[model samples]
Target: MDHIRRLLGRVTAAALTLLGVSVLIFAALRAMPGSYTELVLGPLATPEQKASAAASFGLDRPVAEQYGHWLRNTVTGDFGTSLVTRSPVASEFADRLPVTVTLTVLALALTLLIGVPLGVYTATRAGGGRGGAAGRLLSAFGMSLPEFVLGSLVVFLFTRYRLGLSVGTYTPWSEGPLASAGSLFLPACVLAVFCTAATARTTRDAVLGVLVEPHIAAAVARGEPKGFIVRHHVLRNASVPVLTLVATLSAYLLGGAVIVERLFDVPGLGSYLVDGLDRRDYAVVQAGVLLAATVFITANLLVDLLSGLLDPRLATAAKGAA
Candidate 1:
């Protein structure tokens, strides 16, 4: 019951947050000095033509009425027609969302596979092995390197090595899974590196903290295997911080992947958003932002649920509050 209440509360909050963001976006776009009407029409378009176009898009209406109209249409799954594409915003989002989702998932998977082990190794060995120093050095590198610079370096190495590949064009998986994966590989790595470093640092810290606990020492003294003690005792306690790191990294990874995708020339939401923004395509910008926000919010909610599941004490606390 408590879990249910907490979930409901979170959902409500997310909805309100989304609503507020939408309103802010709308206001900011409207508050801009240049006319969106002029953007859609040529610079030489006569005032009459601009007026007619504005009327057609309902821009001629009072701001409140226009907002209400847009809000209602948005709620009803009609995000208005795109000025650039002349298609519904919903349709444009539907077409681009899958590509972004796939890229984000792959990037996140790579981050987890690499980061968790690095963190565990760092924690277990501490100052005892050469690997700890290496981990710290790698983390520093990851933190200092910007995504675009790292992406360019990866591309340079791959091309120079005669890997016979480039990052800008995408091949569909259905057409050739290997080719498609190859295309995404560089970009995914670029997006994952920073996230991996962040998660590693968090995991290392969490594990080290757990290592000094009296209970952990007791487990070690009882002839319990070192693997079992680290896995069950240290990791279990360390997970909360690790999960937070993962969640934050995941959100950033998804958003940052846009730059990578654009650099690589993938047809993901990031690239799409960039195109839309360049053209000042209001509908497309709104739709893309909304999609990004939805993904980020949903990811956070999932993390919350997972955290509760991992820590029964948290669940119990929620239930008690309820």
Candidate 2:
């Protein structure tokens, strides 16, 4: 019952937040200094055509009514058709969403596979175990680089070596898995670098904290081997922060894919978002924002729920606070 209540509360909050975002976006978009007539028609469009177009799109309606129409259309899965493409907004999203989803998932997987272990290794060392300064240096280096610079370096290295890892072109996984994986590798690595650094730092801190606990010291004195201490004591306690970092990084990965996707010429929603902005395609822009917001909200909710499960003390505290 407690968990259900918490989830319901989160859902309600998310819905209200999304509603506010929609209204804000609608108002800001209308307030922008250009008329849709100027964008869709032309400089020479007669005053009569401008008035007709405005009425046709219901732009002449009161702002509240316009918003109501938008809300209704969005709920019905009709994003009011794209002014630029004349295609259904839902179809545009359908076409682009999978590509972005793939990129996000791949980037997240690489981040975990490379980062979590490095973090554990650093933590074990910080716990006064075998490894040395080299791991620390690597973590610092990974942490310092920005994603754009990382993407450029990845492109440079692949191009310089004429490495097959270069993204000459994209092939869908449905076409050929190996070809698809090869094309995605560079972009994924660029995204992973940022996530890895964040995860490693958080993991190191959490593990070090766990190591200093009295119970952990007692275990060490009992001759519990270093490996056993890491596997049983260090990891279990460190997981709280590790999970938090991963979930947060996962959300960043989804949003940040725009840079890497554009760099690699991937046909994802990120690229489409850029195109939408350039063309002033309001429907596409609005849909993209809503989709991104939904993803972010879902990620946060998952993190909260998982945290509650992983640390029962946290759940108890949250309930008490509520």
**lDDT of each candidate versus the true structure:** 0.79, 0.78
Measured with C-alpha atoms, the lDDT of residue 221 in candidate 2 is 95
* lDDT assessment of candidate 1: 0.79
Model 2: residues with Cα > 4 Å off, grouped in runs = 40-46, 127-132
Candidate 1: pairs in clash: 168-264
- Which candidate should be chosen as best, given TM-score against the real structure? 1
lDDT of 2 by residue, 146-263 (tens): 7778777777787788766656478887888677777787788778887877887787788788888998999999999989988987787678878877766666666547888877
Q: Please write out the lDDT profile of model 1 over residues 1-322, one tens digit for every residue.
A: 6557778899999999889888888887777767777776879999999999888777799988887888888888888888877888787777766666667777779888988889999888886779998998898788789988988787778767877777577877677867777778778878888888887888889889989999998998899998899888888778987887776665665553667876777887777877777677778777667766776788787878887878788778877776
Alpha-carbon deviation at 304 in model 2, angstroms:
1.2
Task: List CA RMSD, all candidates.
Answer: 2.2, 2.4
Number of clashes found in candidate 2: 0
The true-versus-predicted C-alpha distance at residue 78 of model 2, in Å, is 2.9
